[model samples]
Structures are given as structure tokens and as C-alpha cells.
Target: MDKHTIMQYFEWYLPADSQHWKRLAEDAEHLSQIGIGMVWMPPAFKATGLNDVGYGIYDLYDLGEFDQKGTIPTKYGTKDDYLEAIQALKQHGIRPIADIVLNHKAGGDELETFQVRKMNPTNRQEALSEPYEIQGWTGFTFPGRQKQYSDFNWHWYHFDGLDYDALHEETGIYQIVGDNKGWADQNQVDTENGNYDYLMFDDIDFKHPDVVAHLKEWAQWFLETTGVTGFRLDAVKHISEDFMADFIAYAKTLQPELYAFGEFWKDDIDTTLRYLDGTNYQYDLVDVGLHMNLYQASQNGADYDLTTIFDGSLVQIKPQSSVTFVENHDTQAGQALQSKVEDWFKPIAYGLILLRQEGLPCVFYGDYYGIEGDFAQPSFQEDLDKLLYLRQHYVYGQQTDYFDHPNCIAWTQSGDEEHPQSLAVVLSNSEAGWKRLDMGTLNAGKTFVDYLGRCADKIVIEEDGWASFPVQGGSISAWIEESI
Candidate 1:
């Protein structure tokens, strides 16, 4: 069973120091022991500053090497430390994935004066402020790094627009205009604010040939430098689909089997499919649609359509293209997208993503290691290890979905020759009751044990290849063969 589980190894509020890499390397054996196929480590590149998350990307070439951006190493750790961690993970049979942020750049070394028109916040298409001169943080000389890997510099011409005008002390979406420069045209984004192009300051114009060449060049160089197995393209919806496809294609040239995936980050299935289709389905996308559905059900409880958990979701439409996940760093606490699934429904969400036969599931480090923030409590980490164990072994073979129950739904996986780990997964959002499932006749004589050890009772299958079990209210259970 070639199932691969990617662990999102870092959260937003992690300690902003140089110990993360060493810690990850130290935990490599344990992670591999727990069956982690890949580790989606946080941005190794230097950010706006030492403490800033890698999303505010400053130097793509500098993986915590130079003493720029007010620090030598990244928030995670130093360059050599990161490399050591990658080596450890690889040695432990776990691949490392590098997070790539190409949509925008921030914390420039110099500010340049430029004329820009401000767009309405509600309606980004309409320019409110007339073209005015303001010093924009668009110039990046990379003085500290001294353009080691690639000396290609960045300026206003390399970007389409920005959000702030430092000279005016004002901030709004501004599309830098000139003979041929305004912003990325209407073709390159979701139609949220008429044109969702200018997301942040100094939005890199993918349309620029120089920018495209440099990004592609940097991608190959980064892959070679870090020896990463693949990439997690960040905020891909903000960039042009064409550019993303081209860039991934170029990176694949260096490593054809590179496991590239994108963060399209749309809740609508059609929009997501359009994006996938637009990019010719070059990379898999995070199943945000499934996440929203789970979130809604978790919040609504019995009143919500529990039977339609996967309804209208990308997983339902195209399972192979979907990468399932529960709560990530952004959704944990005090982040922009903070619609967290309540703790009660976490097991159900995890079961739906992990126990099911479709979609590659990603485990959040916040949930795994217990994330606590000023706004939210520690995440749900208990009993999750058993779920991962079930996924690694019993999750193989044909799947049977029992989505008919409104308050309670269940499924079973008939173990195949490769894995005799047949199991039943039942979840309830309301009051508990008996859920009858078909576990097949292969293990009819053998009683099934509660694999997670949460339930004391075992299920005895009748001659009809069915077994009835008690399901705790608002809880989930995975029952495996007694021998398992």
C-alpha cells in the first residue's frame, strides 16, 4: 500500500529561534516510526525579519545564511541545520517538502518613488486615489546575501502593484500603471474582488519575463541546494495559473517525479476545478471544500447535513487531486482564516480524511504536538496516533461508505491480500446508538477489537458478514480484527 502521509511540521506561533531544525532532525526517527511519508517543513528562507513567518518572503535564495533581515538564521534555524534536518528525514525514509512563496515579496532593503492609483477596498477594480508619487518598498538589493545564488534584483517593474504608500502614510490596493504596467490582467486569479490580483505589497508580476526566469532559476537552485523531494506552492491562487504551471514544469525538469502541490485555497469546487483545469492539473490542491464542509458540520452538529460531508467537495469530484487536512497553522488561532473545527468533531473529521480510501491526508503539526495560542486552547492530539496507525495498515483495500445516517455515519474497509487489517470506522455527531456495519466474511469467526483501546467491548460478526457495535455520542471509533 503506497499511501503517503505528509506532516505539516510547523505552526505559525512556533518558537522564533534556531532550534526548530535541530529538533526536527532529532525527531526524524520517531516521525518515520509513526509512518510519516513526508514532512512539509515551514519556509526555510529568510523572511521580512528574523521573527517573521516565511510567507512574508524577503530573500528566496537565503535559507537562513546571510546576516540580512536583522538575523542570520530563519525563524526555524540556520542553513546547515536545515540541511541536516532534511538529511535526517531522508535517512529515516521521510521526504522533505519546501514551501514556496512567489506571489509577493516584502521588507525591501530600499524604497523607490512611484506613481500609483489606489483601488477601493470593497471593489478592487475601481481606483479611488489618483496617480500620486509615493515611496514604495519595492527595491530589493539583497546586500547581506550579496546575490550569492542568483544576483537578479527586484524593483517596481518586476511587480504589478502594492498595498502601502509609505510617503502618504496611507494603505490601499494600488495597481502600478505606465505604458504597459497596471496589474496582472483579469485572467490570472479568482474573481473575488473583481480581480484578486494585488494581494499584498510588491506583488511579483508573473507576467514579467525577467521575474518568471528568475523564479524558475531560483526554484531549480533551491531544489538542488536543499535536496527536497517536492514543493508546497503557497498562495498559488494569487499568482497566474499559467505561471505556476510553467514554473512547476521547469522544476520537474530537474526532478521529474517532484511531488508538487498548490494552495489554491478556494471553497467552491467549480472554482477549484477551474483552477486545476486552468493549470492543466499540474499539481494537486488542498481540499478546502472538504475542510469547509467538515467545519460547517462540526459547528452545526445534528442540524447540519452530516450525510453530505463530502458533498460538492473536490474529494468527491476528483479524489486523486485532493489533499485532505484538518486544521493547519492558519486555521489554528489568531490567524486570518480562523474558522476552526470544534474539538468534539475533530475525530470525525480526521476519520473522514484518514480512514477513507480517497484523497491524500496531511496531518497538522499543531494538532500533533498540541498547539496553544492566546486565542485558542491546545489542539486535539489525543487518540490521533492510533488513527495514524490504522491509516498506515488497515486503511488499505476496498472502502464502504455509510453516509446515510444524519446524526451518525460509518464506513468499513475490507482488508486485501497486502494487508489483512480489515476495520470499521463509525462516527456520531449526536446521541450514540448501535451502528451495524459489513466487515465482510473474511474475519467472520474472529472477533474485532477496538484498535484505539478506547472501547472495552469487542464486536462479534454474525454469519451474514455484519457486526453491530456501540458508538459513543459525539465520538468516533475504529474497530479492527482481534489479532490486529
Candidate 2:
């Protein structure tokens, strides 16, 4: 069976040319051929404007279908273009995943006077001032859409907070005053900033029945309209866990086998696990701890303990419910969560995720295709392609781990009946090193070579099916049986 690999197809600094959908459609076949089983497309909904990157959501109903947000087409393309891209991906046997941003709403149509209390930015639970009237952009009429899909006009009652006070021409965390309206419970959201329920923009009040109903309605419409097989939920740690669990459950009723994962963005494995539990394991979580480990290893270089790479990682404890990635749009340079793994460690990081049989690994588009903005970086396409090829063809069977060394680690996969192509992987963070690891006892005396072509010398397995695999300093090598 082929390994399931996911590719995040968009980056933070992509060109604002509205050709991303077309580019994805054009590259569908190539993506499939390169063993990408799933592709996570950027937010299809219209954002604040042309170059908003879809995070600052404006109109959920207007997916480039209306002239809202000052443009007929989104940063990617039009609605027709997005649907065509989905079809193209499906035709190529790739599951398309949509990015869902439900934590807040932005680009409201008009300002509305509402009663609010300024909350302490450091401690959201603390009210800094008494209730006062202020005009906020909490009215989202979506006039450009003209009530096309749904006529659910958002008002101040549907949200709990906002960052800007248009009436006062000032900025502060203003908690909207209403009955049963406040941030989610301390236990329901992240512990950061006292209570993390208030992220940015107009924070949706999950406790409100109208807000919950409309969100559910929109989710169903999004699924049926897009035909996407999965979703990549954004900022889950800030949203109410109960609502998320209920939403995911409701979504599963429509598509029983829907693949859902959230960006918790918490480096603490226990907190992430608590979220998974809180949501009743309704969806998987991105292994932020593992990503941090990779980033630290990259930064510390040889000083980092290679043997403890997976220590305290979600993948280490709950592999089945973890979505592993080296770097992502949020973690890329110049972003809020900019803990990027260095260039030299990318190959090693990719090797750890791609060649392993643990978590479902995801490749970042920025790393594979290169970043294209002020904090631009070169692409690792060549090395990533090689690792991906090895994963698709050579990686198989029972695994053996050799993580005794602090700087050098190695593992091997014993061939199975269907796939006889066994593989051995060796990596070193310090100086050059070699590990005498056993591939298997079957068919000894066979010759093996480094598929990465980093090492020129070949090694012949002994009668015991053991050979010393060599790798260069700060590099990784995947050794496989030489082709006949």
C-alpha cells in the first residue's frame, strides 16, 4: 500500500496574482505523480481584500462568487476556478482539504454602536472598564453577496468581542456586553493571555444559538458545495472546544469519513492531548511539539541530542492522531509563529517524517517550491523529491530503531510480501558517522547503495544481512537495494 502523504499547497508570501487556483489545477497531475495523496488548499472564502491570504475572512458565502472584498476574484481565483481546481484534484485521485477559519470575522460591512467593556490584554478575563457605548464594525451584511447562499446577517449580538472601536478611533480588546456573552471558559481555550478565546477581529460567540446555527449551516453548505474530502481547521485553541466537537460531529454526519485536523499551535503535548480529549478525538492535531523539536534541533545543530528528537512529541505518544510537519505557513519566516527549521536541517526533518511509519507527514509548499517575499528562501525541491520518491517506492515493512547515539541515528524496514524493497536510513547531526544496522536476515549478501547519492561507496551486506551505512555530517541517507 502506498503511504499517505499530505502537501500544504500554499505559503504566506505567495504572489497576489489570483492564479493560485489555476496553478494548483495545472499541477494536479504532477502532484499526484509525486505521491501526494492529499492537498490542503488555502481558504476559498473571500477575505479582507486581494492580498489578505484568506485569514481575515469577510464573507463565507462569497467564495470569489460575488464582488465583495473589493474584488470579484479572491487572492486565488473565482468560485468557478476554485470548483474546477477541486474537480481536477479529485480526478487525479488527490483528496482536497479546505482551510476553515471560524474563530473570528473581519471586513464587516458597517459600524454598529454597542455596549462593551475594555478587557486587559494580558488577562482577558479582567474587565478594565465599565460598559460603555462604542461603534464597532460588527455588522456583516455582506451586501455584495445580496443574500445569495444564506441571508444570515451578522450583528453585534452574534459576536463576543472586537479589537477596534471605530467610534473612538482607538484600539483595545473590547469585550461586547450582553447576557451570556463573554470569552469561552478558561478550561475551554488555551491558557495564554489569561483566556485565549479572544484572538483577533470579531470573535464569534459560540455560546450564542444564532451564531452556532449559522456556522453549522455554513459548514454543511461548504462541504456540499466544494466536495472537499477534508478540512484544516485554523486557530482551534482559541475556539470553544464544545462547539468544535459539536461542529465536527455534525460534519461527520454529512461525510462519515471526513478527514479533519486542527492547528492547535501549542507546543505542550499535554495541552494538545487535553484538546484532543476535549473534542472527543473528533479530529487529529498538528504535532506542534515535534515541529518545535525540529526547529530547536536545527538551531542548536550538533549540540542538540538527536536521540531525544521525538521526546515529548504528540507523534511519540499518539501517532495515529498526529499530523506531522516540519514547517508550515504560520511557522515560515516573518509570520507570527516563525520557528522555522533551518535550511540545512530540512532534509533531516523531512527524512524523520517522510521515511517514518508513524504520523501522517505533510510537506510545506514554501519548503518545496521556495518562499517568494521579503523573507525569501531557496527551495529544497531536489532533496524533497528524492525523499518523497523513496517514501513512495522503497519504504516498507517492520521497522527497527537504532537511536542509541546522541548525534547519529539509524533505522531499517524489513521487506514485506507485496513490497520487497527494503530500506535503511541513517542521519548525523555532528560529524560523519556510519551505523552497522541489520536490514533483515532474508537474502543476505546483497549489495546496497545510498539512493540520495550523497555517499559514493557501496556496502555489501554480510551473511547476517548487516551492513554499515555511512552519512555525511548534518545530512541524511536512505540506503536501498541496488536495482538489477
State the weakest 10-residue window (summed lDDT) of model 1: 372-381
lDDT of 2 at 277: 92
Q: Model 2: per-residue lDDT, tens digit, 1-484?
A: 2899999999999988999999999999999988999999999899999999999998888889888878999999999999999999999999999999999999999889999999999999899999999999999998888888899999999999999999989999999998998889988999899999999999999999988899889989988999999999999999999999999999999988799999998999888888899999999999999999999999999999999999989999999999999999999989899999999999999999999989999999999999876999999999989899988876778889999999999999876787788899999999999999987677488888998888987888888877888999999999988863
Return the TM-score for each candidate structure: 0.97, 0.99
Q: Give lDDT tens digits, candidate 1, residues 1-484.
A: 2578889999888878789999999999998988789999998988988788789999899998999988999999999999999999999999899888888999988888888788886777888878878788999999998879878999988887888888878877888876567655677787788888778868888877888888878887888888998899898888888888988888888988799888888999988998899998889999999888988988998898678888878889999999999888778768898868888888789888888889989998887887655754565556677888888888888888888778888888887888877889888889876688887776677788777665789788888788896778888888987865
Candidates' C-alpha lDDT: 0.85, 0.92
What would the C-alpha RMSD of candidate 2 be, to one decimal place?
Answer: 0.9
Overall local distance difference test of candidate 2: 0.92
Give the candidate number with the greatest lDDT: 2
